[model samples]
Target: MNNLDLIVVGGGITGAGILREAVRNGFRTLLIEQKDFAWGTSSRSSKLVHGGLRYLKEGHFGLTRESVKERERLIREAPGLVEPLEFRLPVYERRKPGRWTMGLGLALYDLISWKWNHRYMPRNEFLQNVPQVDPRGLVGGFSFSDAQVDDARLVMRLIKDAEMNGGKALNYTRVNKLLRNSSGKIEGVVTEDVETGEIKPFHAPCVINATGVWAENLHPSPEKNKHIRPLRGSHLIFPWELIPITTTVSFFNAQDGRALFAIPWEGSVLVGTTDIDHGNSLTDEPRITQGEAEYLINSLNHTFPGLKLSLNQAVSSFAGVRPVVSEGNVSADKESRDHVIWKDKGLVTVTGGKLTTFRVLAYDTLKACLDMLPHCNLDAISEPVFESRRSITLSHTVSETVLRSLWGRYGKETLTLLNESDEQDLETIPGTRTLWAEIKYAAKYEKIRHLDDLLLRRVRIGLLLSKGGKDYVGRIRSLCENVLPWDNERWELELKTYFMLWDSCYSPDAFQNFSR
Candidate 1:
């Protein structure tokens, strides 16, 4: 690491992808994250490896095609990470798009991804809605193929792959300054470990600035604020038994045409996602607004008359900003999902683009950066070593029916996850598979410091469980007692600090009066 060829300044998907690609290319690389990996938008995504079916409405055919093909690659390259999910959109006369129109759109979507029509997923078709949702007054629905993935886990796996290929990653490390030579060319950066408060200077020939919403913070300009708009999109998680739709439910907001989704996740039902133009940085945690919660409940009620969900029913909720490139619209949801890469001197900044196409974005970024490289046998390199047969996991398990279910989310890594532990490691935590093993693994391997980092990103119990992981503070503290080197007083203080951090998500008055 003394002499580095490249340095990436973010641990999000983009940064992780760049580092992975760079290392595979045999570049001496250093990747540093201010907090934990996927601490920003990468962890806060809708958890879908999708092709942007809704974007097709806006005539974004190219985006859809690219996403579909990239999705195919993900299922192949990372079987344990990317999984196929069937999405069902119930067609009602009240809805604008009729059965035929929706069917035609899906058929075209199938055509775009015809290469793998038989291997991975089925083509879009009509199916009977699950009995949970009232099928009354419902026309035929359109079902299509997409994939679901654990965002944080995928980011971790990418970093793991990069590490396996000789890349240096430092968590709790902050890049305070971007260095440039006298010739006005970007060269390296100034970084510091937040815990040690130690500063260090690192040099790299090429730098990719994939800090998502924090791009402007690294290299700000007069128009940086206008360049990126941070939108706060929120979601509420509930017990899976409550949601009637077994398949991923694709429903539109009756009041507005915005797309909303309800997917099934680890023994719990996933419901969310109300997009608004406002936002807060990654440092400050965000919460779902009352209006947003009410809208979600009403969407469920309207689509499924038998079901009733109150705010109290919401086990937990989360909110994060989407760093979409500004497209003349103040509304974040209206902004284009396309990505933009900018190179000033030797620094390359990539912002925007959907989650499903991250690898492709990385490939494009690496090829472009190498092409722009002064000269280093760039053309001599043949193909990348990204694809490997090392992946090893399947959903088949002898435990409970839930084992198969959990394996789907965990992937080939699930086998390693299970084999790494004995009887003690099998103990599960709150919010689905928030096991003690996972907590330890996050610290030992995945770079976790504070309880917030574990609950929010590593385990996701913080967002999907009530009390924002306050219920599991004892579990974490007990582990800190045995495994982590901390005093009882320190453990108690960590628990308290975590609660206060969780409280920052919502206004004091809002949470105090926020009863169902």
Candidate 2:
């Protein structure tokens, strides 16, 4: 058995962060994911790297402070992945915490962010930015600075960087059982290769469970490990033409008082996020319920009364189960966004945090578990290594927008990807800024075992297009068939499986079952 210093389970942002830091500090670290990287809550986020403006209202100053600082740091460290975003919070007579009150919140938000492009937009100025918004009873709004990110790409890039620094990451592999020494102190893990059905055992001094909502399963005593209260958050995406908007609009739902965000994303408008207790089988993929679709549609209709957005206009929908920590009968929305790390008979489970604060969570998890490995040098743990600045000039034929997009997605690898691609791969997909070369690159290097992993997780053409971007399936297969080495039968079966999964797990129609 190959003994390792650390074994981080779950390939979400939290585990990725831990793996990066561990390897940077000279610890032999291994990260394993049951499916593709970022296939869980990480990829399905709202894709914002904000300081949790809502958290400030809930009086979580500590979380807000850490998040804002990390948010700014990420913006500077990974400018290619994180872009500055402007948000507008429209005020109405019926809405509580009216204009002036919200203005106070923005002031605090800026203070927390160290500094921000915070300003109050008068009704006319706001209307200019969001013309589709219903100007009736609208008392202007407050504009503030945050950021948006390619959530899935961020995870993949972090893992890539970790690998560059000597970390090992495996996708399509799972930890089938936990190993314990005779004394019952933590020893190692038993893993299964999901593809080859091979079982293997490895020794490690520390095993960190960062498996989000699924953390409960690995506990030796399942009865005592019942902290997770899975909250399902669902989102809807629409064509930009139908709901044109330049900035994110924050609205408070009249029905449940939940905050909703309708933002412009990937040349489309993304409106989402409903938080409710998930009372279903946790084994299957999460889906947006019919009530969630209606709720989001109604929230958008209320905010942009002129648009009258309907459920049918939704190009696609997605849902992710949050591994929130809670007890008793508290409302799901009210659960603390803070994370917790606790050691058990042999394993350490870390869960309950937001995407914006994943780095901090990783730091804390490492600090908590380091003492367990007495032989390890404490000084080895340090800050994560940020990508170094590099200058590259591209061909004049490549437009500035495309060049920037490529760098943002590929970072240092942009040059190699561009140099290897033909002219056809340089062009963007019809409806999205993603390029054909991205699909090819993922197939060749990103461990894409299935068509869904390529379209859905690798490039996001699946979520960005209607019917999960089926129109481009033939083009994609042609581009990546050589790299993926899929036979015609395998390709057909994978395509069929991809479509079935998408329709059942990521389509607006998936919500119809919850309508009644």
Candidate 3:
């Protein structure tokens, strides 16, 4: 038996962060993710590491402060991936929260977050005069800041950092069961490689389950461990030029407290997130039902008053499963977003958290795990999460915020794709929204063993565009032949698999579901 200090299950941001810290502290760390890193809800997030902008409205100020601090830290530390995002809230008639109320809400959001916070971005108030805000029903707009993150990129960087240290990380592998000793302490478990279907046994004293929605599979029932009510948040990407709001626009869903964003990603506008209750079955692809798409489209139209973001202009769509803690609320939207890390006899199961607070959650988990082990060092370090000078230099590499955006989230890890993409032409991958080198690099350093992993999680090629294209997938399939040793038959299968998953998860309406 190869005994170790810890084994982390789940390779989302939280698990990856803990893996990075554990290995840095010299713990013999092993992180096993059942699928590609961030393939679960982590990749499907609104892709922001914001201070709890909504939490402030709900008066969760403590959570906001911690999230704000972590957001800044991540932006500074991982320049290439996590970057500051400014959001403009356009006041419209009959919106749930009126302008005065929202103004108060945002002012409070800035008050706690701005405290001791370095000037990563200008304060929200300065952007009020910016003409980039849609001057439509946007009577008056209040601007605030959060973060825009390449959720998958950030997770990959963390995994790389962990590997850069001594931590061992295995993806596309599932943890079958938790090992137990005579005293019922967690001793690790059996794992199976997804590609080869080979099972292997490993041992560790502590096992952290960060498996997100799929976690219920690890235990007999999630109710037996902690409660996780799976909620699906779906997003729609539209052509960038249509209502190209330079800043993210947040509108209160008149139907519910759920919010929406018309924020820029890559070159398009991302409008999303309908919170609906989901279930036990977990799949890489979940289709967007007609009702959900209509709801989102209608909501955006209502917010912008006439952006014409109908199915005709829809480019792409994506969905995520949020494993929110079941707090006796019939509504998934009302479920608490706070996280809980509890020991179940021996297994340390982590549940219920958001993107903004992933770092603090990881730090707290490290402290608790180390305290459980007397000899392990959980010593706090004074190193700021990011280097300020490097952050500034990187952002200036492209435009007002390109390099800073890349370097902040990736740190030194940005070099992986930067070297490749820099040399290549700025061409979108055939059939997808991704640049060519990104997919090329994914095949290289990212260890994208399969196309589904590359298209969905590695490069977000298929998900970023408004119209999902079968033609583009075929083109990528041909390009991939230059890198992967797939036979023509296997190439077709990978191409079909990627589209099938997308279609299944987003609905089979062919026209509505196929392209955008």
Predicted model with the maximum TM-score = 2
Candidate 3 lDDT for residue 247: 74
**How well is each residue in 1-516 modelled by candidate 3, as lDDT tens digits?**
265788899999889878887776778889998878887788888887788667675667787788887887877666556767877666654655777777777777777877532222223332453334334444465667788888887788778777876788888898987888888877779999988999998887778888877666775344554477888888887767776667777776667657777778877777787888865367535556677788888887766654555765777677788878775645666666888776675577776788777767787787778645536666534455544534322211344354444454445655555654544434555433455656666676676877778877877766655334555665566556677878979877877776666665643243354446
By lDDT, the candidates rank as 2, 1, 3
Candidate 1, residues 1-516, lDDT tens digits: the string is 678888888899888877877777677888999888888788877889878877787788898899998888777655545768877777776667766777777777788887433221222233344555546656666657688888987787778778876898988899988888899787789999898999998888778888888787776533454477777777777777667567888777777767788888755777768777754445655566777778888887776677777767766666667877784645556567887788778888887776788877776777667754544443313342234443445333335543543344343445666666445756666447556666665655555677777777777777666677665666666554555666778667767777776665632123433342
**TM-scores of the models, in the order given:** 0.87, 0.95, 0.86
Full-model lDDT, candidate 1: 0.70
Order of models, best TM-score first: 2, 1, 3
Q: After superposition, how far is residue 401 of candidate 3 from its true place, in Å?
A: 6.0
RMSD of 3: 4.5
What's the true lDDT of residue 516 in model 3?
68
RMSD (Cα, Å) of model 1: 4.4
Q: Report the CA-based lDDT of candidate 3 relative to the real structure.
A: 0.70
